[model samples]
Target: MIFSNHVLLRESLHAVLSTELDVTSVGGDDGEALTAAHKIRPDVIVVDLDGPGRHGLRTVRLLVAELPECAVVALTGRHTPHALRQALAAGARGFASREQPPAELVDLIRRVGRGERMIHPGTALATLAAMNNPLSARERDVLRLAARGMPSAAIAAELFLSEGTIRNYLSSVVRKLNCRNRLEAARLAEEAGWI
Candidate 1:
């Protein structure tokens, strides 16, 4: 199965992968993907992880939790080590860049289906750096929005979190990064490519 918000990419992958494997379903949203995954019970699920709002990572996590037997392969446009680490932490068995050829993705899917875990070589250094990242996913989200110049109230509204909660997260981020303020923490996270 293939999951991506981009219709063209999903259809293209389905077209190519269906030739060699049983492409059970192609989904463009989390609800559809989860439903199809449950019904089809595909052996391998390829998820595009670079989607807006990091919904792909959430889907990967849910799929892993709900369908423990299914192997997940994270397909990302960003080859950053942080991206690879995030996918792996979410329970993906394989990580591949979208820049890779279709055949390579197919091979990765096959390998992951066979229970062999792998990460893209391009993320080797990034992966090492990402290990030192002290922020949690929610902290990253808050810091990312903060980095974008959003005020705490706006960030809270955008994230559907309380203002106090947003402030707490920001404070936690500052403390974790050992920065004097949220702005400095955001700058540091941005420089480190953690947000």
Candidate 2:
């Protein structure tokens, strides 16, 4: 099944896939996709990662949770490393660009339907980079607050800790990230999608 808000894109995919495979299309809306999945029980579902007004991560989460037997492949034009990570975290089994050849799309879907998993190489690198981040969860929380320009006092109040504790967290974050200051550590975490 192909799920997308853009009618023309759905039709285009349907046109291409219909020539060689069975296809069903549902609107990008979450409610409609869930309902169709229940009724149609498609072997594989293709959803647009950048669909209109449809947060692809949430959609993928819902489909994966409600239709665990179905394989989902997110199609997108954005195709950024962070976006791909979001898709994988949401439980999508496959990822493909909208610009991929029709034959490739068909093959990817088929492979995923047969219980294979796929990840873009760039996304794998992003995951590796994320693994290298040495900050603890508390340290990351401090940096996230810092990214919003919060002072130590405010972050302490928000976290229900002392100002000195917040400062300690900030210092830890900076040391772990090997940065000169808290601000630089915060910026690095934010840029890496950690915050």
Candidate 3:
């Protein structure tokens, strides 16, 4: 099974995966993927860990707890250690990066199906660096929004908080990251995979 919200990318991934492996199902969003995962009970599930509306960690957590026999592989473009840790913490057994060749992803799926642990080296390093980060989870969230070019008002609206609170969060994030400004803080946090 495969879960992805990107229409064209999902289709392409489906095509490639189908040629090498028997894909039991494919879905566009959280609900569809969750339903298909339970109904089909596929041997392996490939989850895309991007997209603003998608919460891949939460989905993996649910699927892992429900389908212990099924292996889950998290796929991402960033190759961040924090993302890798989040995936593994949610019970994902494998991590695949977009930078790798297609053949590697196929191999990762097969290995994961056979019950193996895996992660890209870059992600591993990021995971280690993430351990040293000082910001809280909420701070990370605010910084992530800032990294996306979202102002305090917009971030506050999205997070259901006051604009002043959002600014405070950003200020704290800057201090913790040892950055001169919000942009610098966001950039450093992003590069370190803290957000």
Candidate 4:
């Protein structure tokens, strides 16, 4: 199955893959993909990871949790290490750049369907560089909320922690990133695709 918000990309992949395998194209949010995936129960799901608001990664995670038997292949234009790491962390079994030839993507889908994990060579290099992410999971959570302009108190409420704890997390993040303030830390993390 092919899931992407871009109609052209979705249709193109479907047309190409349907020649040798059954294909289903789903458009919209992660929820839509999950629904169709449950009904179709496809062997593999190709998701566009560059979707707005990181919906593609969310979809990958949801599909992996709900349909562990179905392999997921993430396609993205942004081949950054952080993107690759995020997709893998979200449970994607395969990763490929959108710029890759269609034939390569088709082969990746086939391989993943057979339960083999794969990553494009170019993306693999990025993953190697991504090994150095310094923030803890909790720190990332706090920074992510802060990046959205949430005050420390608001972030604390959302994360069910005290405001002082939220402030401490923010301080740690700033110091770890060597930034002058939380705002700068958030900006740096966002630019590096760390959050």
Highest lDDT model number: 4
Encode model 3's per-residue lDDT on 1-195: one tens digit a residue.
888776666778888888999985465567777789889989899888784566877778878988889899988887766667678888999998867677778888998888888786677877787789898989989999999999899999999999999999998888887889999998788767677
Candidate 2 regions exceeding 4 Å error are 77-82, 99-101, 134-139, 147-152, 159-193
- Score candidate 1 by TM-score against the native: 0.67
How badly does each model clash, as a count of residue pairs?
0, 0, 1, 0
Query: Global lDDT for candidate 4?
Result: 0.89
- Candidate 4 lDDT by residue in tens digits, 23-70: 999999888999999999999999998766658988999999999999
Model 4: clashing residue pairs?
none
Candidate 3 matches the true fold with a TM-score of: 0.69
Candidate 3 Cα errors over 4 Å, as ranges? 128-180, 193-195
**Would you list the rank order by lDDT, best first?**
4, 1, 2, 3
Error of 2 at 133 (Å): 2.6
- lDDT (0-100) at residue 15 of candidate 2? 95
> What TM-score does candidate 4 get on C-alpha atoms?
0.68
RMSD of 2: 4.1
Cα lDDT tens digits, model 1, 34-143, are: 99999999999999886655599999999999999999999988877557768889999999888877787788889999999977766666766766889999999999
Model 2 / residue 87 / CA error / Å: 3.0
Colliding pairs, model 1: none
* lDDT of model 3 at position 18: 88
